[model samples]
Target chain A: MKIAEIVKTLDGSVILGKENLEKDVEMGFASDLMSDVLTLQTSNILLITGLSNVQTIRTAEMADITCIVMVRNKKVTSEIIDLANENNIVIIECCYSMFKTCGLLFQAGLKPVY
Target chain B: MHFQYSIEGGDFSRAGNASSQLKKLLKQLNVDSQLIKRIVVALYEGEVNIVAHAHRGTIDVDIEPDKVFIRLSDEGPGIPDIKQAMKEGYSTASQKVREMGFGAGMGLPNMLKNADKLNIESEPGKGTIVELTTLLR
Candidate 1:
């Protein structure tokens, strides 16, 4: 699915990389652990994580995840946004819990990386 | 080409900078995307390991026509038993590190899975050294 549709489905606001709204992401991986993310070995993944920090952005960059959906309405700092922009990673903020975010995206045709 | 980066222990904010830069270098050299992915993942895990466990460390990356080699050497409380440290669910990371979404004890295992070769050397009081090699072919 294109990222824009995902924003609508989850009532998520684009916090960065709006220019990438049309990018296609087919798989989703929900994890707060960066190591689990590195193990994915896939690209164009939508990382559903509640861990909002520089570390999260770093994980996405190394793992080549396309976008990050921050669950639980976590606030993103400027450092995180700057790094995400540098890495060309899109960030979306949502108030839904991680489970709900994943379920909603899964229902919308996003495949699980597993 | 050879590259070097330094990692500061407990500096979670800057942990993956080395990996990111090495990734860009590999891309500029037109390394295969799959190989680059593996190399980057392994290096990033090593970088994070230093940040989470060591006092400080240095990363040396040597890229050849057919391979990439990385060596990380850190000065801190080294692992007394590398076998235990390499176990999938064993970690000595503190709660602060855990709060950053790391410290799951998966770093070394991920590095091993992604890198073609992995070597670890540690001294209980001195430090640890992790070396990873990935063949481009």
Candidate 2:
């Protein structure tokens, strides 16, 4: 599904990479652990995480994850947004919890990374 | 070609800078995408290790036609038990580092999984050195 669609479905707001909302996301992985994200080998995965830190962006960049959805309306710092912009990673913020966000995305036809 | 980057221990902000630069370099060199992914993962993990554990470290990257070789040497409290350190869930990172979503003890195992050749050497009071090699396919 496209990021735009996911945002609309989850009532999310784009905090960065606004131009990338139309980008296609093939899979979704939700985790707060950067280590687990690094272990993933998939490309174009949408990282649904509650961790709002620079390391989230760094992990996304290393894993080639193009999109991130910050759940529970986590406070994303300016530095994190700036890094996301620089890396061309789309950031979406939503009030839904991680579980709810994943469910909404899954219901919308996004497959799991497994 | 060769490149070098220095890492400051406990500096979480700049942890992945070297790996990001190396990824761009490999892309510019037209290396295979799969090989590039492996190299980036391995090197990024090594870089994070230095940041989380060592006092300071250097990342030396040597790119050849067939393989990308990386040497990460750090000055800090070295790993006394390489065997224990190699375990998947073993980490010595402080509580602060753990809060940043790292120090889960998966760094070395992740490196081993991604690199074609991996070697680690360390002395308890001194430091640690990790060598990683990924062949371009």
Model 2 lDDT at residue B5:
99
* lDDT per residue as tens, model 2, B1-137: 99999999999999899999999888888887777888998898898889999999999999988888999999999999999999999888898888889899999999999998999999988999999998887
- Candidate 2, clashing residue pairs? none
What DockQ does candidate 1 have relative to the true complex?
0.89
Interface RMSD of each: 0.9, 0.7
Number of residue pairs clashing in candidate 1, backbone atoms closer than 3 angstroms, sequence gap of 3 or more or interchain: 0
Which residue ranges in model 1 land beyond 4 Å of their true spot? none
TM-score of each: 0.98, 0.98
DockQ of each: 0.89, 0.85
Write down the TM-score of model 2's second chain.
0.97
lDDT (tens digit, per residue) of candidate 1 on A35-104: 7888887788999999999999998988888799999999899999999999999999999999999899
TM-score of predicted chain B versus true chain B for each candidate: 0.98, 0.97
- Each model's chain A TM-score: 0.98, 0.98
Candidate 1 chain B least-lDDT 10 residues? B100-109
